[model samples]
Target: MSDSTSDFLAADAHAQRRYAPLTRVIFRLLLAGLSGFLLCVPWLSASLYWVGWFAWVPLLFALRDTRPWAALLLGWVAGTLCSAGGSYWLAEFMVNLKQVRPLLSTLLALLFWCYLGLVIGLGCLLYRWWVRRLGGWDLLAFPVAMVSVMALYPMLFKTHFADGQVDFLPALQAIDLTGAPGLDAVMMLFSVLIYRLLTPRRSPAAAYSRLAQGTAWALLALWLGYGYINLYEWDRRMQQWDTRRVGLVQPNDAITLGIPEPATGFTRESPPEMLATERLVAAGAQWVAWPEARYKGYFDDYSVRDSYARAITRHGVPLIFHDVERRWVDAQRISFNTVALLDEQGELAAQYRKMLRMPFGEYLPEPWSWPLLKGLTDLVFGEFLRPLGAGSEHIAFDLNGMRVVPKVCYEAAFPGFVAEAIHTDGAGKMLLFLSQDNWFGETSQPFHHGNMSILRGVENRVPMAHLINNGPSLVTAPNGRRLASSEAFNRAELLADVPFSEQAGGSFYSRHPQLFLNLIYGLAGMLILLAGWRGRSRVRRRGRRCSRKTRPTGN
Candidate 1:
């Protein structure tokens, strides 16, 4: 055979081998699993956070030269695997706390994983579509698509590429300017650059590629540089600010049927939490915080009020604690998950009700609350589903003239919610995040929950004390540094000299929280339009060429 014929035969055989069913499936699964593992490890432990910088490289590689539908499938597989691995605590939480059967708990966890996976699948689909229309501009197309999906997609628990970078303090500082979504975009850009560097054959011209890489590195340096500067500035400001001894009490209470036993009753003259509070006060704690749900009964109850009053009056130190608030609204008994403050005299200074209630945990959503499904929901959820009233206002507690804003449980996870709370309360001086994480047990859940407080503090330039009932309570400075922390599942008390600046909440992000996110949305829109225009122009050019070729030799 001739050389060209032999070469063609060889190429045909290679294509056949590459497209074989078993080979393709194995390769795809390997790539997806690898990407998922890389993404999950960082979420499991902060020490592994550096792994997230290139976590998506394998997924990008798998999607290369693949059809949109195939790319979507690969991305979904990777994303589902990542979420399932990282959030394996969910199954345990469901089975132990929510009273779900083992099989049903597993299935629910799977559904949750798949739901989050759709965001990644959609992002991959968009990326492939853009590549087909506008060539391999992964640098721009990939980040924009991923960031847009993460920003727009709604989930019970929101996840972002930046979540894995929570421990990377220097990188986290930029969040004050751009929010988590911006950090996500930056991380995506880094992943794309790494992918391009690894697969030079698939990248742009060598000079252009080098320039892009250089620019990315330069920007990264500037980003970290800004972080260092802010870190120093915040630290300096903290030194000059008024300092007060703050204490966090972790009860480490036992949970039964998803509710903490300590939360329900305080029959003892001095419960463990109260004793801890007394000890902290003796240790010179000017202000103390107790985790959410520690006092479950109605705060209006005379007994409960008396108990809180006795504790606060005895110590003569301001205290913040959580309880259930009852109100008679239109002859209906409505309850609220509330965090309240008591002055030195044990008077109720202020109370902030939890605004963002956990979907199934605290309140049932639309379909579940619908009349038709009420029976099934009630049967399945049982007493675990106690719908609480939502709060309309963000109340701040005054501690020695400093305003302290309070967030209950997962409310701190939301950037806008925390920012609004601070802004609404005249730029609150400190943030007190009250949480009960016992339902999830000693899993990575507590760590993940605590990590969120880091960004919230940094974004608003305020000190934060995240007090959890099941430990891993922490104190964070405005620079995202953890001043003190306790291990999960351990009953512990933490005391840190938390500083509060007279000038609080002037961070650019605090004033204009949505500015960066809106810019990202605009950029994504612009890219989509550009891709469509390019595709249309290509089709028109091809149409003209075909018309010229089909015209008979009229000349």
Candidate 2:
């Protein structure tokens, strides 16, 4: 070969070496993106639940042998993409309901998506650090790190890796024992097992991978067996429990913008909600409920309050409805998102003030509340962001000798919060969730919200009547079974036979709310300490070898 030809070949090899890292990075990013897309599939539609089982496989491959920071970046990429896909309706909700500009709404949505991504990124960072410190025990390190981040990191919207199993009733039965985080652990453990099994034979983890794989399979089998048994037992108990006829009203009303003013009296002779209530009563509903903001006027107005009472009096049944309560505090008018109950005599029986305030909707938090950004916030949100006062106590009402716990809009999203409320309220026999989901229109937001609320009932083992405006309202049994439902953007009245068991206390999860999470925290802390100690011992061994090699020796 000529010298010129040899030079050309050398240049070609140099170019490949120079661009190899870039090519590899691009490929890894694509894999992460694919994983993100898969992660969102089950959330988009329940029928695609199978996709969630293997969704994280590509992301695991991408993190293999990667540096700590690089692993975080890849995890963030996957998480952000997944959040963006799953919650694409957020931008539209902001623009249409909050009256925000399209560009600003898109930017805000992107910021939230990135914020949620931090949880996954931090998990990956921990996993990489643990792997480096404790050798190649991917099975233990991956699940612990991921579960810890998921359970510890706080996000505006709480989503679990196990949410994909929402439609899988048998798998969901375990949540009653350990809450959703346990399912998250199960999902992660199984994913890591699959990752190890598929690893190449020459890889370091391949030798003991079979042992780990066998153990994982055995655990999974036991878990599924427990799920089946619990599901059957819950079904049997529900069948034997007494049933109460409840009416759920879905008004399908358009979300009115701006803060509403106190009305002098009922404006219309017969509002659609009142008419729906009357129909439900005629259909043999013993109790009735209206969705949040269904009564647009302030209940503090005596005329408006009387009008609701008179309607309930005519129906001859107890009624629960959502309204805004205004009171004078410090000589200033304050508003509360409240759920009011009217007895059979058309008199006020009990009321529950909403405890959990939605971050941007009911109140502003942190940087948004800064005085300097007040003008900008006002321009984007206008009067939509009402700084409502939060309630301090968990309140429950009586209906036909049974305790009914009420939860307002955003309050239903939190697992621990809901469990605590039920536990504190004397282990309520029934749950009533009132919400206005019209802001999200006909998007998947309403469906996702309703599904999550249904899970709360299962966790606590109580019947639930989830009433929503512009829903997908649901009446769920204690076992997470849907007894009745209403379509979105439709005027409908559902008469459901809600079943309730006469148990002395709530489910184990509701009774011991923090036990599972605390256990996870302790386990994660121990593993981190163990990793640090092992890392120090390795360093000491290396130092000893170096010192022995350099020591002077006599012949």
Candidate 3:
């Protein structure tokens, strides 16, 4: 239109052209590969979580200057690699622990990684579309699309039973309102902003790009500020807790559930679990928790019955044990990972059947129930393919002063499940998480599982006590502080206080879960629709313009 406007447009075109070299197929592949590896490193260790902040920056940079299709495929390569790297532990679990045949395990691993990669790839496609199609709103649109990618990650990426974006504490502090999806949004925003900040600009609106950079910094500042404020409040709230002394007994006796024999080099003769319980009571524990499948037989067996009864009556304290119960479900027999509470008077108080089963570890699919498959599972793989059917109802136990919610292993990762269990019975209860961590052995699986439990505790504002076979058994306060813990595979009894918050307030996340996420998902959907409409309108406009230009003069 105007000369100044023409110059501005030309400058924009030049700037856009500057990124043209990055569009080469070779460069796209390399950039994507590099990005995937970078993203994977931070998650490999518990200590390297800091790496996540900028891990996707490189990928973002590469994607920003490319065609939508090229960017999508490039992102797929990175996403696939990232998923595989984070979950490489699965291959180990299959071969070394479950001893699933190599070919099958590899195939399963591939399928899982690819599925996760597909989610990420699709996310990249959306990001490219939004940033390219949205004119004035590119800055805002990019982060929103990025958030959609990350928000879906927690729900979709289950191959490793992961929540990488959730584990970032600064972002996690705001999880009460945002839940997992919101935290993910914050992370994607940070990544997009960081890339934009680092990216050089030649556009006439470079000042606006710089402003976006400033906004990104401001957002980061706000996130950290709010996070620290929440942390301070978390501590202040915990200070007013009416604490109850609790004990976690780590027996170090581990068995592959449903396996006929136990792993070698384990404490063969039960590792004095009764002794550990006594130590817990002596250490001033009003109640003690035990690991899953803690004893050889149920309380019906005289030995287990006498020991548990004596522990309750002798110490005048309740003892909790989690064991597997077999039952018929739909005329098919399956085991239930169940927890039973023994009161001070040596009477059975209540029981909780595990409701949330780990996808692969616990809840194997029905297809594996075929006779041939079952035979292979027994002969080739000594471990159970499927140990249990999920429990139908939530159960809680009262320990004189307060009620305690019980969740078996793997359920700790599901924040909503724990929140519901606590909310159903009203607030002011501690969560007892029982586990046999032996299958994970000394890997990051145990650590990853434990870290996620912190999110659960904080979200519901509930204290949690974890007792594990082959532990690092721990007690986490409502604010996610570790009150007590023992080293893994150690014979020890942990004593800690269940920091029951005196504050009568519950978390917003508990009262209304997934509310923010649903809105975010809706917004993402709208943006996608808008992007599509805009794309079609541009195509139609270009066609009309070409028709006018190509019309023969007086023809």
Model number with the top TM-score: 2
Clashing residue pairs in candidate 3, if any?
471-488
TM-score, predicted candidate 1 vs. hidden true structure: 0.92
Give per-residue lDDT, candidate 3, residue 403: 76
Q: Write the per-residue lDDT of candidate 2 for residues 177-272, one digit (tens) a residue.
A: 788778778777777878776877675553665676787889888888888888888788777777889998887776667554333343643466
Q: Give the TM-score of candidate 2.
A: 0.94
The digit string of per-residue lDDT tens for model 1 on 274-367 reads 7889999999999888897444554655776788788789879998888788898889888888888889998988889899999888788998
Question: What TM-score, to 2 decimals, does candidate 3 have?
Answer: 0.84
Ranking by lDDT: 1, 2, 3
Q: TM per model?
A: 0.92, 0.94, 0.84
Report each candidate's C-alpha RMSD, comma-separated, in the order given.
Answer: 3.4, 2.5, 7.0
Over 4 Å off, model 1: 1-22, 202-213, 258-269, 294-300, 424-428
